[model samples]
Target: MSVNARRLAAATLATGVIAGLVGLACIHLLHWIQALAWDMHGGTLLEAASAVSPTRRILVLTLGGVIGALSWFLLFRRNKAITSVSAAVSGTPMPPLRATWHALTQVLIVGLGASVGREVAPREMAAAFSAAAADRLGLSAEDRRIIVACGAGAGLAAVYSIPLSGAVYTLEILLVSRSGRAVAPAFLTSGIAVLISTGFTRPAPFYTVPTLTPSLSLTVFGALVGPLLGAAGWAFKQAVARVGAARPRDWRLLLTLPAAFLVVGLIASRLPSVLGNGQASAQTQFDATWAAGAGLAFAALVLAAKTLTTFLTIRAGGWGGVLTPAVALGAGLGAVIGLPWAAAWPGSEVAAFAFIGAAAFLGASMNAPFTGLILVIEFTAQGPTILVPAVLAVGGATAATTWLTRHAR
Candidate 1:
C-alpha cells in the first residue's frame, strides 16, 4: 500500500474501534437504566412492560415523557435543529455535545417505556464521536464524512447484530453511495462493532422464524399483501410528517406529552402488545396461538393503536425512532392477513408472512428495499426460501408507495 493508503487504513481502523467501544458502552448503559427504572432484568420495553402492572406502565410512560421534555428543554432549548446522522455524513457539521445529549435522552425515554425505538441513540452518538475523531485526526472532509457514516452503521450493527445490513444501510441510506471506498469502511466498522458488542451482549437473532416451505400460493399471497402494506406505510409516513411539522412549544409539550403517555397507558391496559417499540409484541405474535376471529381483531387493534401512539410520542417531544414500531405494526398486519390463509394451507407459517410484511413496510417507508429485506432476514435468521417473497413484497410496496405519493403530489 502507498503511504497515503496506509494512513487511510489506520484512520479507518481507529474509527471502527472507537465506534465499537462507544456502541458497547451505550448498550450496557441502556440495560442498566432499564433495570434500575423498571426493576426488570434484560429485554425490550414491551417485554419489560409485561412484567409490570397497567398502572405502573401508565406512570412510567408519563414520567418518561415529562423527563424527556425537560431534558429537551435544557439540552436543546436553543438549538432545536437536530441533525440526523445522514445529514452529518453529507458534510453538515455535527455538534458532538448536542448529539450526545440527544442520544442519551433517547435511551432514557425508550427505557422508560416510550413508544419508540432505541436504535437512533447509538447511531447518533457513534456518528458524533466518529466525526469528532476524524476532525482531530486532520482527515480530509470526504474521508471524515465516510468515517462518520461508517460509525453510524457500526452503532446499528452492534445494537442489532446485523453487520451486513448495517453496512448496506450506511452505503445505501446514509451516504447514498456504492463506491468501493464507501463499502470498505462501512463493512469494516460494522463488523468490528458487532464483534465487540457480542462480547458484552448475548449473540442471538432478534426474531425467531419457523421453518417455511416455498410455494406458488405463498408468492401470490405475498404479492397481494405487499401493496396493502405499502399503502399503510405511506399513510404512516404522512402521519409522522404531519405531526412533526408543527412547531414545538412549552404548552404543547406539557399537554401532548402526558396525553400521549395516557393514550399509551390506556391502550396497554387492554393490549399490552402495543407498548414499547413493539418488538416483544411482534415476537409474541409469531410464537403465540390465537383464535382466528379474536386474533385478527386484536392484531388490527394493535396495528392502529401502535401507529397512533407512536405518532403521538414523536409529536409530543419524546425521542426515538420508528423502525421498530413499524416492524411491529407490520407483523400485526401480516398476522391478521395470514392467519386465515394459514388455516387453509396446512403447513404455511404465519410468522413467515409477518416477516414479509416487516420487510415490505420498512422498504416502502424508507425507499430502500434491499436494506429492509436484508434487515428482516438477518433479524429473523431466516433462510433463502423467503427471499423471493420478501423481494416481491418489497418491490410491490415500493411501487405502490411511490405511485401514491406522486399522484397525491
Candidate 2:
C-alpha cells in the first residue's frame, strides 16, 4: 500500500478506538449522574422521576440548570468557540480541550435530567479526538474529513450499539456520500466501535417491544401517515433551528437556563416521562396497550410535553441532539393518528403504528430516510416484515421534507 493509504487506514482504526473509549466514558458518566441525582439505580429514568416528589423534581432540575449554566459560562469565558462536527470535517480547527469539556458538559446536563438527547455528546467527543488524531497522523484533507465523520458515527454506534445505523448516519447524513471511499471507512469504524464498546454498554435492541405483526392496516397507515409526520417533522426542525440560533450566549444564560429548566421541572412534576431525552416516553409508547381513545390522549399529552421541553432546553443555552426527541414525537404522532385509524380499520396495534412513526418521523426530521429506518429496526431488534411499511413511509417522509426544504430555500 502507498504511504497515504496506510496513514488513512491507521487513522480510521484510531478513530474507531477513540470513539469506543469516548462512548464508554460518556455513557458511564451519564448513568452515574442520573443515579446520583434521581437515585435511579436500576429502573428507567421515568421510574426514578416518578418515584421522586414534585418538589424534589423541581429542585433537582433547577439545580442542574444552574450547574449547566455555570459550566458553560466558564467554558466559554475565554472566548474560544468550538466548531461542530460538520465544520471540523470541513477543515475547521477544533480545540481539543475545549471540545472535550464541551462534550462532557452536555453529557453531564443530560445525566442531571436535562430535557435533550445524549447522542450528541459522544459524537462531539469522537469528532474532536478524530480531528486531533488526523492532525497528528498527517492525513490528507479528504481523508481527514472521511475519518472524522466516520469517527462521529462510530461514537453514535458505540453508544447505541447500532453499527449499521452508525455507518448509514455517517455516509447518508454527515458526509452525504455514497462513494466507495466513504463507504468502507464508515462501516469499519462504526463496526469496530460497536464491538469494542458492547462489553461496557447496553446490549442491542436498546428499547424492547412485544411481538408486532404487519398487516394491511399497518401498510396503509404507514403510507398515509408519512406525509403528516413529514410536515410535522419539518416544522419541528425549523422551530428548533430558530430557537437554537437565538439561544442565550452571554450573561443572560444563567437566568434563562435555570428558568427554562424550572418550566421543564414544573411540567415534569405532572408528566415525569418528559424528563431526560424522550427514552422513557418512547419506551412507554412502545409498550402501550391502551385502546384507541386512551392511547390517543396519552400520546397527545406526552407529545406536547416532550416538544415544549425539548425546545425550551435548546432555547435556554443547552446543547444536545434532537434524535430521541424526534422519536418521542413520532411515536406520539403515530399513536395519536393511528388510534383513530385503528378504530376505523382494525388490524394493527397502536404500538405498531408508533414503531412505524418513529422511523418515518426520524427520517423526515433528519432528512435521512435510510438511517431513520435502520435505526428503528436496530433499536428494537425487530424483523424485516415491518420494513415494507417502514421503507414506504420513510421514502414518503423524506420526499416531503426534501421538497419543503428546497422550496423554502
Candidate 3:
C-alpha cells in the first residue's frame, strides 16, 4: 500500500478508536445522570403528590417536564445548534458544544414527560463530536462520513448494549444509499460501545414475555387491526405537521406546554400507566386492571392525545425523541384491541400484538422500518412468534405510509 493509503488507514483507525471510547463514555454519563434524575424526581414527586392526593403519582411526570423545559429555555436555547446524527450522514460536521446542549434538552424532555426515549440525545452528541473531530483534523468527506457513522453506532450500541442492531442501524438507516466502505469503521466503534454498555447494565434483553400462541381467531383479528393502525399513523403525521407549522405563529405556542401538561396530568391521575415508557405496562397488561374497561374509543383518544401533546411539546421547542412515547401509546391502543381477543381466546398473543403495535407505529412515524423492527426485536428479544408479527405489521405500515406520500415533493 502507498504511504498516503497507509496514513489514511491509520487516521481512520485512530478516529474510529477515539470515537468509540467517547461513545462508550457518553452513554454511561447519560445513564448515571438519568439514574439520579429519574430516581430523585420519581421519589420526591411521588412523595409530594402523595401528601395531598391519595391518588397515584402523576404530578411527578408533569413537574419533571416543567423543570426540564424551563431549564432548557432559560439556559441553553441561545446556542447555535449543531448538525445532528441524521444530518451528518451527508458528511457535514457539527460542533460538539451544540450537540451537548441538545443532548441535555433531550434528557430533560424525557425526564419530564415529553413522551419519548433518551437515546437520541447522546447519540447525536457523540456524532457531532466525531464529526467535529474529523473536520478539525481535515479528513476527507468519506472519512468524515465513516467517523460520524461510527460515532452514532457507538452511541446506540453503548446505550442499548446491542452492537448488531447498532451496526445494522448505521448501515441500513444512516448509510441508506452509501457504499460498503463505511462499514468497517462503524462496526468497530459499535462493537466497542456495546461492550461498554453491556458492562454497565445487565446484558439481558429489555423485557421477557411468556410463551403464548395466537389462535386462529386472534390471528385473523390482529390482521384486521392493521388498517386501523395505518390510519392512526396517518393521523399522527398530520398532527406533527400541524404542530410544526404552528411554531412560526407565535411564542403563544408555549402555552400549550402547561395546558397539555394539565391534561396529561389529569389523564395520568386517572390512568397512570400512560405516563412513561410502556414496556413495563405492556409486560404487565395481563393483570393490570387499568387495561380493563378501556374500549377502542378510549384507546383512540389517548393515542391521539399523546401524539398531539408530544408534537406540541416539540413544536414549543421542547426537545426529545419520538420512539418510546409512541410505543407507550401504541401499547395502550393495542391492549384495548388485544384484551378483548384474550378474553375470548385464552391463548391469544396479546403481547405479540402489543409488540407489533410498537414496531409498526414506530416504523410509520419514523419512516424507518429496519430501525423499528430491529429495535423492537433487540429491545425485547422475544421469540420469532413475536418477531414474525412485528415484521408483518412493520412492512404493512411502511408500505402504507410510503404509498400515501408517493407523489409528495
Best lDDT among the predictions, by candidate number: 2
Better of 1 and 2 by lDDT: 2
Instruction: Report the lDDT tens digits of candidate 1 across residue range 193-298.
Output: 8888775354767876677667766688788889988888788778777877663645467667777787777777667776666676677666636644467776
**lDDT over C-alpha atoms for residue 81 of model 3:** 41
Candidate 3 per-residue C-alpha lDDT over 47-114 given as tens digits, one digit per residue, 9 for 90 to 100: 22334342323455556556655655554345524465778867665667667766776665454444
Alpha-carbon local distance difference test for all models = 0.78, 0.86, 0.60
Can you tell me which runs of candidate 3 are displaced by over 4 Å? 1-66, 74-82, 200-202, 212-224, 248-263, 277-305, 341-347, 407-409
Ranking by TM-score: 2, 1, 3
Query: Could you tell me which residue pairs clash in candidate 3?
Result: 64-112, 65-112
TM-scores for every predicted model? 0.93, 0.97, 0.79
Best-matching candidate per TM-score: 2
Count of clashing residue pairs in every prediction: 0, 0, 2
How many Å off is the CA of 399 in candidate 3? Answer: 2.3
In candidate 2, what are the lDDT values of residues 1-409, reduced to their tens digit? Answer: 9998899999989999999988888878988999999998986898899999999999899988998899888887768366888888888887778888888888888887888998988998899899899889999889999999998999999888889999999999889999998899999999889878886445747777777888999898878778878878888888888998888768888899999999999998998988998888788788775553466777788888898999989988998989988888888888888888888998877778888889889888888888888888888887386778777788788888988999999
Instruction: State how far residue 15 of model 1 sits from its true place (Å).
Output: 2.3
